[model samples]
Target: MKRFLSQKINSIILGILVMISATLFLTTNGDATIFHVAKTGKDSNSGSEISPFQTIKRGIKDLTAGDTLLVHAGTYAEHFFSWETSIPNGKSWEKPITIAAHPGDSVQITPGGGKAFFWITDPQAKYLVIDGFIIDGQNQAYHGFKFQSGPTHIRVQNTEIKNTKYSAILVSIPPDYNGPSPNTYHEFINLHVHHNGSSIKDHGFYIQSSHNLVENGIFHHNMGNGGKFFQASLSGVANYNIARNNVFHNNSQSGKWSCGLILSSGEGNMGYNNIAYGNYAGLCILHRVTNARLFNNISYENENYGIYVGIASTENSYVENNTVYKNGVYGIFIGDDAKNTKITNNISYLNGNNSSDKNIGLQKQTGTIISHNLTSDPLFQNAQEKDFRLKEKSPAIDKGEAINLISKDFSNTPRPQGASYDIGAFEDIPQIDNIPPGIPQRLRLIN
Candidate 1:
């Protein structure tokens, strides 16, 4: 029969050339470069500059995609490096590279006595960029800035993450058998995730897959979950994310549905103009969170409830100029089964001082839209010295009612005089004062 069909096509071309040489040696061993470590320093030929490469996984195993590894700024105690299984202590990247540090100097990747600084297993290998560093996870496994399988252009800026037991920037997901695209650009600008450990299930900044962006960061005293606003892991499902104008104060001692943000899982996330105060609950917009939008934020001295649009969400969104104060509960707590929600011009007050949670600022359990607010007392000169800036005949000034929050340029004065459009998250600086005219201005001399 034609010589047995030409030997069956030459045995299918030798099994496709042995599966293309085992996929090119597993993609070149998934990448490798070794300046070799063990406290490198023996006429180290780690490529110039005095035997460099003292671990950073030997310059991230010789990077690749637009490589740029240039970490030089002190503290490098890797006692005996050997990272190859593509960095997998917690998770992420393990691929794309551009790790920097040296502009204004500040690099410290300590873990000599229990290492695991750049632990990542390729969190979706995107365009990486870890800037001015500082990663000290001496405490081990807490998922400090990790990523499991999709590192798409992730950029951690002005880095400053400590301890690490669960949340100091632990991005999730990228391994459901891969299948994603659409311009992934995970970004965290100006980071400074604090002391670490919030313990009710730690987290100071935990993101889920989706074109992400966490802006102007600063999350202090994280006790347990200060910023967990998505659900792309443990089953994956989060969308176009963005948590802007960040600054969630003393992230209250973590746990028990802790807050300062724990949007708790998936659904087109978006928490704008953030500025949550002494947390106990400054936002817990729970599971299946909806169109998520907690406008011009400024949640106050929380002891509980300054916003908690809970489960079974839909059309979910409690909008408008926000500024919920001294909350003990009820500064807007619509979770009796959140539905059709969308409360506007919000302005909760001194909140119900834990009468087991009261003061009832606007607790609607169904379809919402509480208009033009000024729920009283918006006075403040120092909400713990971080200043929420407001206090000139404050009725939250002009009883603000405009609904397009997210305008802040103070100190640079790009556009002051909020037309008294003052609401929350500061914007009441119409207190202008510039006296130096006792004798100036051509010596008007009024003493």
Candidate 2:
């Protein structure tokens, strides 16, 4: 009987060893692995379809390239959440690791008692995608998301980030680092960031990375600027970044000098087809930022300068084809030390505090061109209803020069329907001659 029992025990141990080996083999050699996480799961269970992991921390363990973690519907509360150094880098963009919400599920991340909700660190974490998550700050002093170091394609999409004390999203590389590459090639898409920056200096979205794209975003109700792009002099300067087709409204509620969109000390940055309203200022390009372009945007009802280019060393900056109306200060403010700036084909009217103020404010600037702009009311379809579209008899219709840089209007429509392009964010769609003139019916011509 004792011999039989010992043989049985040996068989059981051998079976467990075989199982372990099989698991390891599957994890390493699979084409792509998919893990699941649920609220009813336990950390001790294997990350499988049936026995899923409990916490996001456990689900992300051993995440390799070409792996995906699908988080089911649940409220994940945590303090100081982090994706640590063990995150494996993808071999290429085609093999990125994805952390996303499961189908027909809602995933939310809120701070339980921590300072920051999520922190993504390490230089090796590249080609990672985070999508379809709601990060709620809950009015606590917490940061929504922070990326310390990045390079080559870290994407965050379809995310709602709100009510954070600091910036809703920040990509910051260390000021004094000896890394081979700076943060570059990041993208933020279809994000809604609101009600952030109550305590500290916070932006709805802050970027310090080069060649990044922030598109189709809604930035509103933040205490600081709607979006800020800054380039540090010590590190590599941000260049070739683009912010397109975004709406910036009701930001900078603190009455500071923050604008709807501000680019400080950056080069080759472009902001186009954006709408800025109800902010302290609108579209401020300041602090030695050069080679920036602002075109085909609408700035209205802002408290200060509608389109402001200020500070020193600003040159080669072009502001064109924008509509500035009903702002509290100058419609287009070109401040001191700004050089080689071109302001053309914009519609500026009904701005400034009183009759003494003008549509364009110029102070100690050189090499500037102001031409082909209209100061009359653009005859919006309905001003109180926020319909800024042009009517048939409006003066701004087809009154702009042809700018090759901008081919599409605010509605993404092709420009220049008539003699020339319209002089605003919106291009007036040409009226079709639908009704024929009453050619005398009685005197009919031979068919």
Candidate 3:
């Protein structure tokens, strides 16, 4: 019968090549797995690497999706340390679920009275990855990392949140979350949030959740109440979030209503190359903010407005090329419920306290749009060691106007280098004539 039907079609192609070689040997040796944790180990030991595990809640109960617990050197006072129920969701973002801090080893967690010293409500805690670590909330934790019921791709890096008694990172979204805005894509890198809050509504990084991302952080001092009102060291309320290259300083303490970076009730929020100083308002597009976008930031010496577009209904905002200086008052303060705002190519100088204030204060010029701005002296190459760059005969270089999503400045360089933009957050380097043309003028013998 045709040789038994060609040996039954070669035994069904050898059983489909042995089921594709056992699924490529279980996708290359069954992927990840690296738990450990040691305070001289022993929670019934098994988390290998010399049978480690003493508690990070038993190495997070033997993590599931592509695991990795690490955690090695010292102090893990573990007061509330989280994760009692639902905690296992990392089948994506390249198999997340990290929890690091073993590389250079200096762990330290000290939770103590714990209202939070790392407390994630675990609504299935998405692709988690809390790297490094030194979360000390000795002030009796009121929060030093607290993400409520809506975790999304969380990723806290390099960590170093301190003293907490209020906020040192609290990505909210569960005060009965009414559906929609489930704490999206979180990510805070290079953190070093210091001293942490006390009152005045405390905060050191209190994102109310949205497409979050706070980069290169270094929020300082963190304490308030003595200032008796508002507070912040980086606070975004929600909506397309993004704060870049951060470095707010000497937060609250007593600088009054405080703020060293704040974007409220959001709507396309975005602050760039941030660098506020001695806070009390060094960048804030408050209240019902809309279309907010403060670019190339560098608010200086604050103790008052160095950028503060008022409350309630803030609209169509877009303060560009920022570089407000020596603030103590208006260096940019557009209150009266801001409308179509657009203070362009900024470089407001020597703000308030004298010389008749106002470096740019408009309580409501209807549909505001102050163009080409530059209240002189943008020559800073060293404003007494603060070095605000730009000093090659700086009239703020090309006097900026260009704004195609700000190609890059604030140290990342690459913005019009010449012929165009260069008003604030630094983009100066295009002046290289090097004087050698005179040698060619008399060399006519070559013809």
Candidate 4:
């Protein structure tokens, strides 16, 4: 009888422990509470859909880790919504705090006056996601979104930022920051940033952070470079970042020394599958940049060189498999002091007015390797319509040196569809039979 009583007691204790463990797990990683904000709502109400908050500030104040603030369709005229260290950060990417527009709702923020529409300044405000909002700064705010002091693992996606006094998006680790690392692993995806900067010092996106990714963005009509990636100070290195599958055009309204995209003062920075046109310069790898790689890009119709590698010790850079044409200056210009540069498998034709300035221009440089580049017309399918795909029997087809890092083309087609890789951004895919041959109806044993 005592043994039975002791077994019952042990079973009851085990059940209680299991229940406590489950409760803790749910509290840590369960479904998040979603707060709603609408213009018609009031701040005094609970932040539910039926009793929503009126302003974005009130919605943000109640957010915790794994919480979401969903703003409804409306024009919000507020500014300087600062997200500081007092707010708790999400524990991980899976439990990130999110500020987003409700699905199918158009959320526009027109800030009248402030430093920024949104300022993310806290190093501890990590693992946050901002999505699907439109910010029009009306040339009043200094920036649309400004991130500073090393906030990591943040994502801003599907947002449109425009008409700010300075950069639309600025990510910098200032000199005063005593953080452990510069802002790292942030992502800006599917963004449209345009018409922002007021001078040459400003830009569409000014990034001084390291290991960030900017992809699938459209940057245009800004006062400076469409995107500028460089170190702001010694503490912010801006190294190992990637900008891919973006379009940059019509920037540099201040004129001269600006580019559609500029990668400077960084090592191992890469730009691939991008299109840059109608800028002062299409693409620039400049100012002590090391191991910067530009591949599978299309740059044309710009004011100056399609690709310019210049100014103060740009070393060990690689420009490969890009298509450049119809620019005002040399298609690819390597200026003085650029060392150990490799230019290979590019199509540079019809670029400049004179023959001397036409395909490739090399200044006084050392250890520069230029090989397998084409100066002839690359036989586009339709140049007038801007269809840059190669036609059949084009010289660029299967005439490129195979690059180990590039496994796919601009259109995400697999490389090496023929004897070798294609020479430009596109790989011409040959037609093939989709249906397989049928098996024999009656197989006989024949040796």
Q: Per-residue alpha-carbon lDDT of model 1 for 82-162, expressed as tens digits?
A: 235453121245444555664445567765333345445454545666666677765563545665555466677767777
Local lDDT at 246 for model 3: 71
Instruction: Please write out the lDDT profile of model 4 over residues 45-69, one tens digit for every residue.
Output: 8999999999988887888889988
* TM-scores for every candidate against the unseen true structure: 0.34, 0.85, 0.34, 0.87
Which scores higher on TM-score, 2 or 4? 4
Q: How accurate is candidate 2 locally (lDDT)?
A: 0.76
TM-score of 2: 0.85
Better of 1 and 4 by lDDT: 4
Q: Which ranges in model 2 have alpha carbons more than 4 Å from their true place?
A: 1-30, 79-85, 111-117, 139-142, 177-183, 232-236, 354-357, 434-447
Report the Cα lDDT for residue 153, model 2.
Answer: 75
lDDT of 3 by residue, 315-408 (tens): 8988999888878878888877888889898888888864334788887546988888888778887676666778889898998889999998
Question: For model 3, what is the error of residue 446's alpha carbon versus the real structure, in angstroms, after optimal superposition?
Answer: 26
- Model 4 lowest lDDT segment of ten: 19-28
User: Which segments of model 4 are wrong by more than 4 Å?
Assistant: 1-31, 81-87, 176-183, 232-236, 354-357, 433-447
* Model 1: residue 384 alpha-carbon error in angstroms: 36
Winning model by lDDT: 4
Q: Residue 244 error for model 1, in Å? A: 2.0
Show how many residue pairs clash in every candidate, following the order shown: 27, 0, 0, 0
